[model samples]
Target: MTQNKLEKYARLLVKTGINIQKGQTLVINSPIETAEFARMIAEHAYDVGAREVVMRWSDELSTKMKYLHADDEVFDEFPDWAKEFSLSYSRKGAAFLSISASDPELMKDVDPNRMARQQKVASSALKEYRERMMSNKNTWCIASVPTAAWAKKVFPDVSEDEAVERLWDAIFKAIRVDKENPVAAWEEHKRNLKNSMEFLNNHNLKSLQFRNDLGTDLEVELPEGYLFVGGSEFTPKDSEFPETEFIANMPTEEVFSMPKKTGVNGIVYSSKPLNYRGTLIDQFSLTFKNGEVVDYSAEIGYESLKSLIETDEGSRYLGEVALVPYDSPISKSGVLFYNTLYDENASCHLAIGKAYPVCIKGGENMTSEELEQHGVNESITHVDFMFGTKDLQITGVTHDGEEIVIFKDGNFAY
Candidate 1:
């Protein structure tokens, strides 16, 4: 892409995505390989009159080596400045760009248990950050860059350059860069998702049923007064941030949520494989009863799944519940993007870890003691996996005994 074109896309993110205000801070976390695009973004953000632009770069190999060779104390101690910096971002309200394109197997050689612990620490940091954001109302965004490692994951046999180009094309299309005006395109796109939210809100369903060729027969209850939020919210960053501009779904193959901290039941299967800690869990299935995972099966990576479930008391419970239709932009691409960032957006799925407070009414300030009293589960992890496809069906049951067909064969049925 030309510099001008790159700038145009960056401007799209700054103006429409992050809605960069004249004096707001913009943070770009990019890989070293994508410095070119990152610089373009920084310049574009400045052009939109941003007060400051910060950049962070990470090397996958170095990160892996540190975990493999560093002293155990290193994992226990985060730099005070780093923690302070993260807290400051929430306090001041900055827009963040987290570019993830590394291979899922970047740390495959490391010990699995050690890797899980490292993940626990990272997740704990994020949990604190999320809490701060909710309390302070900060806006942030996460996107990916196509790098050599990421390309290898998509097309193992292809040259890195070829993979990068192909992945870039996919991203451009997914974000709707092919449109005449991508910014205008997203504006219109978000409005459509908002309509779906309205539809769900009006349906007033109590339980959702999903039936698909994958042999899925699952029913999940809806929490009372669950608000449907498409893209956007009132936050301290420019209210116009593209991150906020999105409906909760993206390239969205699914519209989903965590089962009522106490209402998930029945059986469901993963339509696609899940990459957990550099291992693949293929042909996975889980049986739930009254919001708890009772029985589960996987053709691969059972140990990782077990480790995840055993991580905390609430790990066995569901965290995120989502809806992904078959006709999502990623699904329409007709490519099995193995990465969860894209794959999860390509199918309806649920998570097995920490549930989002925002997803439930009166969840944010609710303490763990209070939540447990209410029979809602909480955890430090919130991993999502896909299970719904175009061949699947979802039925919504309302409090009034109305069974509404929300999805048929993977597309929204009005």
Candidate 2:
């Protein structure tokens, strides 16, 4: 990438992704592959009056090896300092920008059981940070950078250079970096998302039913006081950094809320391969009974799927329900990006574990015990997978027993 374009992307990220407030510290969690880009971002952050910019490097090869070699006991031990390292930032009202560029198949050979165990430990250790991130208590955004391996996964026919550039082009366009004014474009996109959320929230849906010939027959019951949300809003009543509403993801497209913990039923097969902690699970189908995955089968990485479900009791149920049209910009590209950040935006999906409190009305004020009392699902992880397609259909079941088509053949019916 050219220096000028790099500078431009950095400015957009600093301004729109996390919406940095003056004097706020920005912590960037990125891969070494994105070192140059991270430096540019740090410079931009300083230029924008940011108090500090902490850059953290996460190399994929080393991460993969940790899973490859670590024994089961290692998963149970999490450093207290590591927990305090991030929680301290939350205490200081800091902002975060995380970059994801891992290969779609990076953990293909790793032990899923070990990875799942490791995840549980980390999740427990970082509980506070995760809660803050989920509640929008800290300004945070997740952006994507493409690697050669990921590029090839999207375009196998092209040379590594061409593949990288091609994937960059797609990402740039999807993220609005190609727009004449990226920040301005993002403002409008965020507005559209909030509007969509408002519309859905006003619908008073009781339950949602999804169906397709590919064999997705499921219904998600909405919580009584659920509120659909898109983008992110910092409440003056909630935190110190409350001046602006920031978008959590640069290219967010889904209007999502929560699913009542015991309300989901039936089976929904994935329309795209799911990249879970680096492992890919494809050709999988899940059968849920009373919001628990009673049975599941996957042509690939079956053990990984099992490990994921067994991560905790809450992992057996769903935490979120999101809606995205079939004809979305990412879907229209006709290319499977193979990364959840991009792929999840291409279809309607549901997350398993740890529901975002903000997705429910008055949820942010609820204590952990209160949230659980209200049927909120809690666990060490939240994973999303695409299931929406052009042939997919969904009907919203009202409290009155009348059914309305919320999604027909992939587009919003309302």
lDDT value for candidate 2?
0.86
Query: Could you tell me every candidate's TM-score relative to the true structure?
Result: 0.90, 0.97
Candidate 1 on 273-320: residue-level lDDT in tens? Answer: 777766667788888888788888887777777777777767878877
Considering every candidate listed, which one attains the maximal TM-score?
2
- Estimate the TM-score for candidate 2: 0.97
Cα lDDT tens digits for candidate 2, 6-81? 6778898888888898999999999898898889889999998999999888888998887777675887788888
Model 1 residue runs over 4 Å out of place are 1-4, 134-136, 236-256, 362-376
Over the full model, what C-alpha lDDT does candidate 1 score relative to the true structure? Answer: 0.71
